[model samples]
Target: MFSLLRSATAFLIATASLAQGYSNPGACSGACWAHDPSIIQRTSDNLYFKFNTGSGIEIATASSLSGPWTLTGYALPSGSKIDLAGNTDLWAPDVHKVGDLYYMYYAVSTSGSQTSAIGLATSSTMDVGSWTDLGATGVASSPSKVYNAIDPNLIAVGSSYYLNFGSFWHDIYQVQMSSDAKTPSGTSVNIEYDATGTHPCEGSYMFYYSGYYYLLWSHGICCGYDTTKPATGDEYKIMMCRSTSATGGFVDQSGVACTSSGGTTLLASHGTTYGPGVFTDSSKGLVLYYHYADTDVGLGDGSYLFGWNVLGWSNGWPTV
Candidate 1:
């Protein structure tokens, strides 16, 4: 019994030490604060642009990924055209360039409520004054709806484009987009869910890597850090599943189906960082960019900061 106890203790210590080795985010300055950040680099000038959840989807730009970022202005200076009662702020901006124009999809909703709508906007330069709000994308939810439509993510596979968004209720869902990319073209398909605990999952981002389509999302409680905060290691963390097809058949590294409550954790709280959520790839290698609360700054929405680190791959999975 003594020998077995010593072995278990040694294994636990080794595991904890390994978890603490996650690299800190690369240095950043100027407008470092961001929440639910979506980063993309323009092919035209190679300039980096990051959009975050805020009033009218806050816009910031930097010459480099790890940067002296400057907050330019909001994408929709007048707020979303699709008005919901008591919704003053836009949440979760996902930006992508199709053809010569850039399209940004955002969410309009109040906190913790199922009443939400996903809005779309476009720009030629991605600058503050260039964006034109195109209103709702026809993907929305009410208290009566089965899914909460927030955290909009757009991905193009071959000739088809799909929008993935959801929260709380049914976790994550994907819908095919019309050619013009203005609204949903088909029925929404439920892709991923977490049956564990409160079923907290959102911020879905789909990206094609190698030959597989990877779906990554933030799982667990994201906000309300001061009050209804989740237990330690249960706050927001990045999780992932992959599939050969873009629409479905996603599975975790352990071969567990994502729809059946299976997800492989990609990043979680470690060292001074907590609640690493959201992800976007930059031109500089396979860089994983996100927003996290610094433990030193206190865990809360107000202390959220932009974070990033380049990633490496082992076998077929991504490693931090």
Candidate 2:
């Protein structure tokens, strides 16, 4: 166990050193947002594109893993078509860059409901204003629920594209996408099941880390409201689990098996940080995007603003 831990640690540190030289991740005030961020490493220009769902899913380009990031504003523009739940469709977007084209997978619906489905959009720029939506996702097996089949994320492993998505109702499902890059093919697998159904899990960001496919997600409540102190189980937190395959049977490095009932906690609210996004900064390696609520020292109300932490792997798992 110790040897495994050491090996993972060294790999992370070495990668950071080689991918180092950046000022680091984190920024001052006003860099905040209702963050459900996803990052894409544009190897072409050596730039890391950071994007998120809330605060209207804007694009920001950073040369270094750290600051000096330039904001490109809302990618979808103000007049983009929204389904029904107001403009809440732009939530938890997964972004990828093919060649020079940046593609974003996002959820679209009038209100947050099972009627919600995934939409695909492509842009020559990270600007959503220039993105072209591929239209509605037909993978929703059940047509009753309006907002359930949203939150689309795609991973290109080898030559295959695997798409994963789900909502707060149940487990997330994975379906293979055709190489055409727009449609789903093959069998759909319901890999990660949230058995508890306790409203603590959703948004599974699966990434390959440390020779394992790590599923990082935010658990508990998200986007704080000025409430009367949330109960212990109700506060938002970041958790993770790993599997040899993108599908399932993931366990934390501690051998603590992660199920819907109990999973490994990565980053919990340190008085304010909540609902995080994890990605590898091509310029700086692993990075954690989160929101911080300085309730005790906030900008008035006890809500969260966008915050980030540079990630370092310790003991074969990610550490903040």
- Please, what is the TM-score per model? 0.91, 0.78
lDDT of 2 by residue, 92-206 (tens): 6677765567777776654335666677778886654677766555555345642256667776766777777775666566788888567788766665555664544567677
lDDT of 1 by residue, 39-126 (tens): 7777688787878787877889999977899999888878888989534588887788877899888889888899899999899989
Full-model lDDT for every candidate: 0.76, 0.57
Which residue pairs in candidate 1 collide? none
Cand. 1 Cα-lDDT: 0.76
Per model, state how many residue pairs clash.
0, 20
* Candidate achieving the largest lDDT: 1
In model 2, the Cα lDDT at residue 96 comes to 75
Candidate 2 structure, TM-score to reference = 0.78
